[model samples]
Target: MKNHLKSIVLLVLTSVVIFSCSSDSDSSKSANQFTIEGQSYTLIPDNALLELKMDNHIMDQGQTYDRSSITLSGLNGTTIGTASFDLFYKDGLPVEGTYTITGSLSDNDPDFFDQLLVDNKLCLGWTSSCAVSEAGAPTFLVNANNPTGTVTVINNGNSNYTIQFNGNYRKYDGNFEVIGTSPVVINVTTDVTIQVF
Candidate 1:
């Protein structure tokens, strides 16, 4: 009887441990990670490289849309890269919804967000390999292939946002030649109170 009771208690403890661990896996960004050009990055709640800021509403095509600028960047000693985009909503303030990341940076659609194509020399940095153009700007022979992704924002009802990034960004050269690609998957919970504009 004693041995049987001990076995039952151990089973209960094991079940509790498993349940607790799995319950909050998707609740935050700590469990999510992404890789870019063979460099891996993990999105933590307070990382400097992950940013989501509210911007002023803009008028486009006779309609006003709320805007939010997002930036995700990281470095791995030798190389540094960044992805930037803006979210626009035609309705009132931004709400919890999954928005598509349209590759067009100048898109006039009031209900969609746009991605700003990043130049390899500017956004993807390899200090030693960057070439300066005649305009005194560093230029790269490559750029991203107009990354497409989904941005899912969850408002915690407390001015906090839980954002998720799942997309693909490929490398393309100035001659439109394909070089490489990387899958971007990140999750970040950030406070927008300080970034409200």
Candidate 2:
């Protein structure tokens, strides 16, 4: 026997090269296992389920449109701050693909602020008729209910702002709409009053 059949053919070619290197390391670990799946948005910091709705809006009349709907599932677990959002590869297309979750704290300290509106129309078109509506809720001046004259605030420090509806602030000519976004026939009030300073 030629030296025992050449050492049994070099031990069967070293077991077929260790079974082809363990099948190519299991096909590169299933191609790096990437499967995010239709996950448009899931900003799970303190876990706010996330829900922000804005609707057809165009108000500037008697001004009564202070709407809001950021009911992040009623604060799921609660633990989110320093929040800033803007992530899009394609949505109202602003030629974007930006992300900023720079909050380093173990296990990534709850920071996955995701967003993908895909395209509902909104990529900075704020002047041609004014088009850039979304995220609203801030307009409250109170006196009581009037139409007299006593609105003044020359420069409370000059940040450029003087919206007064004196003598009980005639509802301060409200206009902060965004709640259900449309068909609002006026009657908007979340009840606010903070006279002075």
Candidate 3:
């Protein structure tokens, strides 16, 4: 009876270990999921891209600033979004400072569905006015009009940068003329750093 009891205890311990490992694995997968406006989405990290461009120019008032353009793409080469802003610099180059870029989606712009590319394919069809606002120098904010949220970008210097989308909200049409919200969080360490020069 003693030996039988020992065997049963060992079996129970083994089962517990297995269960713990499986639970951990499942939780790890869930970590990749994010809820925006109550809708959950699994971010495809491999399909993200970001590009930045800088141009120095003098205004009519003889003030010099750097005109910067940022473009974000996902699911492939589809342009998810773009922003343009001017930054004042003392030496014809943008100093390490926080800058803001704001723009609105016009009727001539591409459809929002075409912009949201996932795995080299379009996700869903959405049409709405989206205003983008982003800042630089540490903590950043990428917010839009319809569905509002923040996006963070980190510049590691040497033209290397990282882009993160956190709880970004977007508005879309649901069934029966109902409007819905979709929030997304995507953190991607791009293979190629966005070069700003």
Candidate 4:
């Protein structure tokens, strides 16, 4: 009878531990995020999209390249912001690795996916006409152009991913003019379910 009771207690304790572990794992899966300059935006799965364009372009006589682009958008109160990146792959889809985000791509190198491009933006409301303030209806727009950064993409399998970006981005206004003399420091980490196309 004592052995039977011990077995029951052991089963209950094991079940509790398993349940706790499952809850912790689920909690670790955070919402996707887009950070630009110094502001952070939380993007839901529905608002975030990752498109894989196979055979997007051809170069080097007849070599085909695939393009993977991710667009993350979210709204903070009345303001809306977006962050996006484009990565080119020589063969197929991009695997788990760290990619350089740069404006320059060399035709001599066959590895086109090694270098990538990133763009970011922040605005007021869903439309361009949305007013931030009544004082002359000023709008805030920023872009990361000719950016130099590193983005680490980890494929968690089954279209799930965790991407981390740390880099210096050139800030450009809506008129495509450099905003400040110094580049903007942007760091973003997001866990998302990529929608492949």
Q: Highest lDDT among the candidates is held by which one?
A: 1
lDDT string for model 3 (1-197, tens) is 99999999999999999998888774554444433343333433643333444444423233333433333333212212322122223334333333222222431234421232211111111221222222233432233333233344556676544545444344334332424434555443444334567
lDDT of 1 by residue, 36-129 (tens): 5444544433543333444655554455555555565443343444554455565464446666655443544323222212210011111101
lDDT (CA) per prediction: 0.49, 0.23, 0.38, 0.48
Off by over 4 Å in 4: 1-32, 52-54, 93-95, 105-140, 173-177, 181-197
Residues 90-132 of candidate 2 have per-residue lDDT tens digits of 2232221222222222211222112112222211101001011
Pull out the clashing pairs in model 3. 36-183, 75-120, 142-151
User: Whole-model lDDT for model 3 versus the true structure?
Assistant: 0.38
lDDT of 1: 0.49
RMSD per candidate (Å) reads: 10.3, 24.2, 13.6, 10.3
Against the true structure, candidate 4 reaches a TM-score of: 0.55
What is the full ranking by lDDT, best candidate first?
1, 4, 3, 2
- Superposition error at 132 for model 2 (Å): 40
TM-score per model over all chains: 0.53, 0.15, 0.36, 0.55
